[model samples]
Target chain A: MKNRIESKSEVDVSLKDLCKRFGDFTAVSDLTLEVHKGEFLTFLGPSGSGKTTTLRMIGGFETPTAGEVYIQGELANDKPPNKRATRTVFQDLALFPHMAVGGNIEYGLSFQGLNKKERKTKALKALELVDLEGLYERKVATLSGGQKQRVALARALVTEPPILLLDEPLGALDEKLRERMQGELKNLHKRLGITFIAVTHNQEEALTMSDRIAIIDRGRLEQVATARELYESPKSEFVADFIGVANIIRGKIIEDNAGVKKLLSDGLEFFIPSKEGFNIGDNAILVVRPERIEIGDKARKSNNSFSVRVRNIFYKGAYLEYYTVLESSQEIRIRVESKSSSQDTSADYKTTIGWNESDSVVLTREPK
Target chain B: MGRVTVPKRVSLWAFTILALMFIFLPSAYLLLISFEPSELEKVPRNFSDFSLRWYIQLFHQERLPGAIRQSVMVGLLTAGITSFLSLLSGMSYRRLRKKSYFLGLLIFPMFVPGIIAALSLSVFFRLISIRSSMYTVVLGHVLYALPYASIVTLVSFSGLKEGLIEAARDLGASGFRAFKDIIFPLTRGGIFGAALFGFLLSLNEFIRAYFLSGWQETLSIYMFGQMKGGADPSIYALAGLILSVSIFLVLVALIYYSFIRYFSRSFA
Candidate 1:
């Protein structure tokens, strides 16, 4: 029976307690995620982190060992990939090499039994949607790496599937081309407004393009939030470390009053809102972003401050990285704006570095 | 870079000529002897004494034409069956998790000597009370060709990117449709190679045909019978004819492979 797709709903793709195992190896474990309609959701993680596995489950290319994948409110765990209203732009851009650009894009339409003229028009429209108007007859072999990527995208999108799955689509392109394609893809996502679920190891790409980023590690999801939320208030140490440069300070809760806890790490003490299921005298881990810390005169204004010896200064064009070690020998990195340095903050000596207590987060357990 | 010396160029040309001559000499000798009035055990030494006597005798020979037709039929059937089976199994071969051990098992036939396999198969057929014919010979050749065909097909798959078939299915093609549209087109060259390999191997195979081809005479079996007493000069002519065709097939396969490699290189 034909699965006539219903109207768009609030949630386009819903993965519930999904798990996948290949013999003894668990590729995805108890991963539950909900993707809203028309929002670009990215599963961002390191390789072998189950991000791609989750994407494949959504596309129906993989069957979950446990739990369900729902597309448009219908359970799709048993449905074949072709039966699901999803298309994937694979990492290698698996365009049919023997076919022309038009043929590649028109492949799905052919399966739908569209007539020749209709298929051609639809193929052209899809190509144009990806900004490659005309040149329909160009062989895939002749297309540039970026062009092939666009063709793969167009081909996947031609059928107008409500959700588009991408497995590192810009991975094949060089640095400059990859940057350019990132912008193009973001624009395409905006113009199409489909629920695009993309898997990528690139944190920058996820932050730049995704409406929400799900940080996954070791086959389990660490956290799912907007890019800003993920960067500023990561729930787990893995999410903090994976998304950007994070300095995790191992400490203990010295005291607690109401919901606030006083944390004492090696040669440093600070106050952070107490996490649940933890009390005074319990071990506390503090996560601090490198960019959140201030050095020099500004350090005196913050609630949390420490004296640190400057170990190294890395001069980036936009920002400078200060690698410093506290008297406790706790090494931490601090990022400073290159444009705002009125005086040399690069002295190879002791300096005070600090951030507001609210900027740092205290967790009860160490990361796995 | 230093210029190539005259001696080096000459030596290279000389080596190439010698290699070519060494390879083609036996076939050339057979061809010359077939046209000459040569003895049963001797090759014609003088080109001046060459004639078309062997060719005429070859045409008048009994059961030889039937044997040639049988061999051709068996070759085509075996090649088609072998390639189809290999392509079918080769698809699953890619998805195998324990690929190394399974691949070793798949290629087990190539490890055993052909005579041993033939003998075992013939005995097994006898135990099963199955009569041998051209079909039996075809089956024997299929066993022999399967390993080579699968190897060629699996190599083609290695050159392809992972998840292509999955991508095809993800793009709204069914499993069968994915194979038809994506997998088959991508690996057609390898399938063709398998077919050629199967046909050539079956065409020239003797021990298997000798033991298994009951009530039917394949070309090799017919030739072996002729050589039971003392072989005719006409037999050399037939052998020369078969050798020439096999050579032509080898040339065609070489060109086909080179073309595929060249196109793939350019595409990459």
Candidate 2:
């Protein structure tokens, strides 16, 4: 009870030991997190990873089978969606097709005891805030995909909800439009300093638009941190692989000297950063990013360097990727910016590859 | 759209004209005979003999106008009740797990023969000590029209995307408010369409009205009685009037269907 009171005072929303099960299938399990007062937080996961289910639970659309949900420090497990202080922009945009843009935006205002004139005034204001000032009278069907997305945002905003929940809000837009809206959404969050809880499967969108991102996998909270922290220091192999391109090297820690550790795999030796509780003979996983592995003359200066045969090269417009393999048949990918002068102008050449000790992240294998 | 050969286009036009003529020929014959001036002649002897003599006499009959009024009253009541009930059933159909089973049960009455249904309803009302009246006639008509009404309303509800009601609720609208602001307006076209179907079905119904009518006969019953008693020129005039009214209503329904189609998809 004391902890509950403390959480209510500090957190805008709290989920404690929350679990949701559909028959034998557990959609969410014992998940707990706190959303701060005014921050952009994203729940990022793969499809069917329970991110949307968690968002629905927060918005009062789904009741948890066990545990509790608190909004502004008050227990809200029994509250209906309309009684909660959260509004959601659905995945499909679910704008009322029968109503004009103004009518859709003004729908929530009517419930707040605002008269017809006041509702119109507030709806027009919301439309302008979304950069659609003159589209209030326009029919929803006449709007383009991006315009419809803005109308959906304006509709949810007009209610002045403290917590705005977006379920893949830009999932329907084209790629370029999606990126543009991502920027617009970030701006809106800054301008209106309200809690924004968005759910998405797109890792890039989550990284670009969120103050903090919570990584969920198979109904479990894997990690929650800022984008930089999550990318630079992923705690698990799943996080490293899911967030971006990672070259995971699995081996046993065979040597620990000073603050550096030596890992041995397939008769090859690699150096990694050491942490507490990592002793000799314990198996570990190392996550080395592609761009971090330097080739050519720069490889000779690194602590852990190896010779590899270039297998293939892919020109990726912005960067060039070289697929190389070591003598032990282990594959490695190296990303070099397109403007770099590291191009050898030929394939099937032997080249040395290396990364600094600190750049390789070591993950201690969990006990079975 | 591939380009059609000239012969194919001509044949398509010919088939369309033939279908239209097949549908309207009987109504045209009724209109022509109603103006025959000779009481015994079924068709007008000459275009010059066309007159409004039977039409003037048709309205003077004591019971015909009253019968038409009662039939309209019954039709309105049936349409209102069937549409309201169908709305409830249609909305519930969305929430049901076994949708096909529920719909099958709702539409099961369509298979029952009309004479059998009318006789059973009359017997059941008598067993319950209920007298024949317009309300009873409405009850029978609602039973007959509900299957079609529910289908129409269900189709309308299908066009409504999922999560709309939930979105409205998330935005602070209560359950009732969501229905008023979202559900009703989006699907009102279907509801109105269901009501029109019920009105037409009830107006043309003869078997149930014959068994369940009160002191005042319905228009169908009166027309049936007049046909059996004598083949009068005034009866032909009455048939022409009924045909014209039915055609007008059908035209209105067609216009409404096109209007809603345009209104809903103009932006798309």
Kindly list the per-residue Cα lDDT of model 2 for residues B63-143, writing each as its tens digit.
988999999999999999999999998789878888999999999999999999999999999999999999999999999
* lDDT value, candidate 1, whole model: 0.85
Per-residue lDDT for A278 in model 1? Answer: 66
lDDT of 1 by residue, B1-268 (tens): 8999999999999999999999988778777667667565455567676667777788898898899999999999999999998897777878788888878988999999988999999999999999998888999999999999889988887666657787778777888888888888788888888999899999999999989997879999888888786877778878878988998998998998788766655335
If scored against the real structure, what TM-score would every candidate get?
0.92, 0.91
Please name the candidate that would achieve the greatest lDDT relative to the true structure.
2
Off by over 4 Å in 1: A5-9, A256-260, A273-278, A340-342, B1-22, B37-50, B257-268
Model 1 CAPRI quality: medium
Q: List, residue by residue over A1-368, the lDDT tens digit for candidate 2.
A: 11333443657889999999988999999999999989899999999899999999999989999989988888999899988878999999998887899999998888788899999999999999999989988988899999999999999999888889999999999999999999999999999999999999999999999999999998999999999988899988889889899988778988646645678878888887867888889998888899999998899899889999999888888888999998878899999988966755468999899989898898976543
- Clash totals, every prediction: 0, 0
Q: Name the top DockQ candidate.
A: 1
* Tens digits of per-residue lDDT for model 1, A1-368: 15666746798888899999988999999999899999999999999998888988888878899999998899999999888888899988887777788988998888887899999999999888888997698977888988899999999999888889999988898989888888888899999888898999988889888899998888998899999998888887777777789998888887635545688887567777546776778886889899999998889889788888999988887999999998889999999889865646555798798998788877765635
